[model samples]
Target: MSKAFSAIDEDREVDRDAFTPGVEPQPTWCPGCGDFGVLKALKGAMAELGKDPEEILLATGIGCSGKLNSYFDSYGFHTIHGRSLPVARAAKLANHDLEVVAAGGDGDGYGIGGNHFMHTARENHDITYIVFNNEVFGLTKGQTSPTSPKGHKSKTQPHGSAKSPIRPLSLSMTSGASYVARTAAVNPNQAKDILVEAIQHDGFAHVDFLTQCPTWNKDAKQYVPYVDVQESDEYDFDVTDRREAQELMTETEEALYDGTVLTGRYYQDEQRPSYQAEKQSRGDMPEEPVAKRYFDDDYEWERSFDVIDRHK
Candidate 1:
């Protein structure tokens, strides 16, 4: 185990309320917003794992999801649009001990920020990334989001969107996420359990969180009466096998627009090393926190100019 997780006191009991902001302001998200479920599940998962709030770092991009850190009370960075992943990556690189998480809406993550999403997964950064997919941009007055269904009308696409929705689970798997799963607001218990596992996972964990936007996405199909593939005998596939998981993900993505909401773990690679792990193995990364090196007066560090002078 890395020093990050090994430092935690397993017997310590962390209260869920410890995550609440000092002001304890209620979330400003629209009533019945799917984001509420995510917040609850996160708090529950952290508490269940006995993680201290101080050890966590939540980085969120522009949109309603960015408000998460305000309510989560963790070390937070409310970043610019479609840039949470890079920001989160920098933090993890500087201080690998922090349990980092990045969050954003579908439009923020899958649309404008898609490039970052792909590379971050390909590198297998050690962080949890949650994409709140509501099909429309609720905070921006109900525009078509990246996950919006074909023929789904919005202010931006008044005649209805012609673009096929991005297959997030498939994309995550293809881009090289070590862990991938889908969960919904309607299933809080399952969501909580998944979050716990995702946070516990050692590599890049991507969760396509289905969130309902009642005000903006009233046209969205209700996520109720969902099927859990893990518990259902009808669906049996090993999460560790790439071939099996790939086929299952393809079906699940198609089933979503067809009105069948399939939510569950799709794939995991416990053997894959994370980006930091690879760097450490190559001797390119320091075993201790890079931030800590600044405080060590005895530590000699090479300057950028020194390397340039040597080469000249």
Candidate 2:
């Protein structure tokens, strides 16, 4: 069998509208929901890159953010809460040619699936991970989430949440994500640009997207008047420098709670090799992807019965 199944049609021009499902089901997200911004930026990025919907695989975890796959016209898996990363990692390893992107809310990504997020970054998996940081758990009726600022009152914390919020960008860098960035739903242009860079990165990329929950978290900032670190003269740091990135990320995290919304690429390590490439270099993984073998009708497949007989 030919490898035509994985080939990209470079001759064709891809449109942003192509990613929108033909039978557009009316979106159920509430009016002024920041989730809509994520969808728009994602589609714009894919279209700008000239990527066909067939070439991409989007995996999402449970929460309001999980509905992203439903709106995006691409191969998708809506996995259990906090499990999108692992599923996305498996799919990427199976078919290295597929453009893998994982998304989830703060509670899903930072609370439940945090371990997977850290390890995936540490291993430098070639995947883009977008976390919708809306502070509270929107789908579950405004409960305190892992990213919720300290003292922020929610249904789960009626008086106030004493616990501090996770510094996502700094944590991602320390855990070993090659590309670390922060973008807000309020700034679609910057979000699209960052998404483009994240998708193009060869190693693990983590984007802490600040999405406001207008309906659930009334106290949450809409993330307006955001200053892009790259554009602002007030902020200056090298994205390739670990120490610089760390300092800036810490500042950004602190500033968010203090009413300053700073958004931009924080770190990128171009020299680091992705997990798949490292495995291949060590002769551990096959040159031909596992996905391709499944499509080959003539390829031999070992049977469970044969293994049992051999063991016996």
Candidate 3:
């Protein structure tokens, strides 16, 4: 075949090794970064899903996790800080067939974009939201974030943090996300399982990954490492039971610094209708950009400039 034809075929079909090379430039992450685990799990999940690279839209916010977009050969958008959800929701609404994923670090998702996170879950859009929870802000050179543990010291908190850490899993559960999960970056297999399941869910899904940032969270060596599933019994994973999941999130009796990585689904409800699926069923899908399917003829001028000129 000609070189042009070969190139065309390559675009039409994914190369087996395309995603295998993984993130480019070998990831500038510091030694023992949790983002690495999440990346592997994401690639594995995408491979398992067997979807076209173009059909996958990985939207990310500014942070260490945002850099993930650069590595994947699939369609990716590196949006402003805390804005990934809005973009992902829009993408999914525009093209219901696309597999949209919103990913970002804790600060990006819970700090600046905290409000958006809540609304996104309540909306129940058909998109996957993954938060890389490292406790500390690794990108801003070791700063305290919303999820930073109380009494945790950082450049921004010289005398230990004073504010309470935001419990993302519990918050998402209460926010009405149809699916919720928490996984350790160390457990690539389990992470893949949880992510794929979340993506397959019809409504909004959330997967919070507790990863280590050795450079920023000085206690990385004491807390982060490979996942020990058999030993994770101490961490509650009764996802079907919201009260139990909330208890687990609040019960930090065995914190990561104590050497127990939390992993498992927190909640799931396949029955919940996705934002797009519900709209399509009710014949509420927007036919024009400005309004829904039942827009009045007066709005025709908005759809075409030529029509307005001819009418004038």
> What TM-scores do the predictions have?
0.94, 0.95, 0.81
RMSD of each: 2.8, 2.8, 6.5
**What's the C-alpha lDDT at position 153 in model 1?**
95
Q: How high a TM-score does candidate 3 get? A: 0.81
lDDT of each: 0.91, 0.91, 0.76
Candidate 1, residue 284: the lDDT equals 76
Error of 1 at 49 (Å): 1.4
Candidate 2 pairs with clashing backbones: none
User: Which ten residues in a row are the worst by lDDT in model 3?
Assistant: 1-10
Shift of residue 228 alpha carbon in model 1, Å: 0.7
Candidate 1 overall Cα lDDT vs. reference?
Answer: 0.91
lDDT of 3 by residue, 272-295 (tens): 787776776776675332212223
Better of 2 and 3 by TM-score: 2
Pairs in steric clash, model 1:
none
Report residue 256 deviation for candidate 2 (angstroms): 0.4
Off by over 4 Å in 3: 1-16, 20-23, 222-238, 252-259, 286-312
